[model samples]
Target: MSSTANWSYTAQATIWRCLGRNEDGILTFDRPVVIKCDYGMNARKGSLDIGRECVIKNTIWTEYGKASVGDYLLIGKSSEADPISAGAEEIIHIQRFADTFERNADDYALFTGGD
Candidate 1:
């Protein structure tokens, strides 16, 4: 249940995992998933209505320190750019973003966010 090269889908999977759990440590996909946002998504409480030209990382507006989207601010020629770079981690900027946002094993942590 891990995604290596999928960003938006990975986020959606995160949403799924949030509401998924089963006896065998698997999520039972029995019905549609309902999500409530306490963070992230900009436009509405649980929606990110971005247009075709928006960058995801330039300015992710927040509410009380939590990110959210508002009205027509949803669309644009925006993009997500990561500026953190340590030595030996050049793979992130040059190799990753240049080639594409392909998340390697080290790109994530064992326990992400509150997981």
Candidate 2:
């Protein structure tokens, strides 16, 4: 059986791959790629909170090798859409794991981000 057979990847997102900065010290990204994954968001209390704009606690679980830190993620967006115009989320941290017997799934990457 496939390891990911029971996995629930219910969300769709676009990944803007980072391609290093330019001479002007501006980060650049390649074209976006659409992917399926499990997505979640939470509101946290902190000094950064302002009105209803609390800290965004975002979490995403997807196949390994899909994305990394510095890459941008636009949840509910597609590759053909403009990420900047649609509000893209930055990937701050990534936790990768290999499949295990208890959690029978393919190697996966967990992306956490939001300000």
Candidate 3:
């Protein structure tokens, strides 16, 4: 997935916490994904979470290994996405794009407890 945020300070851009805080799902690809956030020098308000349904379509790469999710992966977004704390009772449901490895249109993941 790709994202952009414009902030003027080096603050907490995104706070990522797992859904179940218990399970780390599957690893499907070979190349690790890259989330390039071209924020301003002092951008203070921008962040994202790796909760679910995160499809990597571009050719970005890294020496680090790739990450993956299991069946029914999901993600949610807003004009604004952020790092937050939540309980496991509610899972994150994310949608997918055509380039995604999955033939379906959605992926979901759940995170519980909090950081």
Candidate 4:
């Protein structure tokens, strides 16, 4: 039997950047995925056992002290953002933060904190 289970997770952006020229705009980020917590009643150890149709709440990205809700969906194990193996024992949350930025002419906005 496949041990892999579907889990829902939330991703929040610590720092977000955008480049715009006139009406055209581009959204970019250094590291935009902060897992707040797992959603499920069946939890084991420190991770939660969330299988199938996971829901994430309060998923937003922040910039210049301003935050915008981010749209994302948990695609079980084996995702591009974070990879997981089937039949995994535990599901550890991943948290990432932006420390620095690259030089560019585009406008940059620094996120202070949560919205």
Candidate 5:
């Protein structure tokens, strides 16, 4: 596998760690953290799911750390300035370097999810 530092990141996004739901049944999140990543969208033309007539899949790659499944990812916006205005997508999957490999600064994480 190629090192993460070798890849060029063209976009930025903010990640909010999910702190789980509250007693009232509302989800709460921690402070947002900005990360540099390479983002792309794939158009699924012939999806079998009728509920999703048109599906667009979003994928992102960034340095491995501070993110996991169920976290909130806000694209094209920073939560520091206006956290309430932007809508966040929940992270469904995370692909990271295997533990079999040696630890290095160049390791990366791949995140897949979004409407």
Candidate 6:
């Protein structure tokens, strides 16, 4: 593990819980979702980058060399392109590209997950 007060890593992580405060109080809810991605921040520049398929809405917490809470994705443990989180669960995959490509000459598409 390279330690410079900043580092980068990828892992297959499961969304264990979604914490929120209701009338009762703070609580943890079920949000079992898994994702594989490449994510990290450039400590020097204070810049962060997420993979094409990884959509990070928010980061909950970071502890024990891992993020404890948040709705985000990060690089998986496998360096290979093979996806790690594969199963019957519903999953949405996102891929980013430099430019749009002609799908069938009749249509154009952008890989940025947006119109």
Name the candidate that leads on TM-score: 2
Tell me the lDDT of model 2 at 28.
79
Kindly provide the TM-score of model 4 when superposed on the true structure, using C-alpha atoms.
0.19
Order of quality (TM-score): 2, 5, 6, 4, 3, 1
For lDDT, candidate 2 versus 6, the one ahead is 2
Q: How do the residues 1-115 of candidate 5 rate in per-residue lDDT, one tens digit apiece?
A: 2353445665788888888889999877888888777777643442323453333356677764768777777766575633344576666566675433435544355444444
- Total backbone clashes of model 5? 0
List model 4 lDDT by residue over 59-89, tens digit each.
2222222223222223132224321112111
Clashes found in each candidate (C-alpha, N, C closer than 3 A): 11, 0, 24, 3, 0, 10
Q: Give a tens-digit lDDT track for model 2, residues 76-109.
A: 7575544555578777667677655655546555
lDDT of 2: 0.65
Candidate 6 has its poorest 10 consecutive residues by lDDT at: 106-115
Candidate 5 lDDT at 30 equals 87
**Alpha-carbon TM-score of each model against the true structure:** 0.15, 0.69, 0.18, 0.19, 0.67, 0.27
lDDT of each: 0.20, 0.65, 0.23, 0.25, 0.62, 0.28
Model 3 agreement with the true structure over 1-115: per-residue lDDT tens digits: 2111122112221123233332365222222112322222221222236543332321212111112222111122212222222111111222222414433322221221211
Between candidates 1 and 3, the one scoring higher on lDDT is 3
Alpha carbon lDDT at 109, candidate 1: 14
Candidate No. with top lDDT? 2
Tens digits of per-residue lDDT, candidate 6, 1-115, equal: 2231123224344433335546788444344444432333322211124433333232212112222323223322222222223211112222222212322211111111110
Which segments of candidate 1 are over 4 A away from where they belong? 1-17, 28-61, 64-115
Stretches of candidate 5 exceeding 4 Å from the true structure = 1-7, 43-56, 80-85, 98-103, 112-115
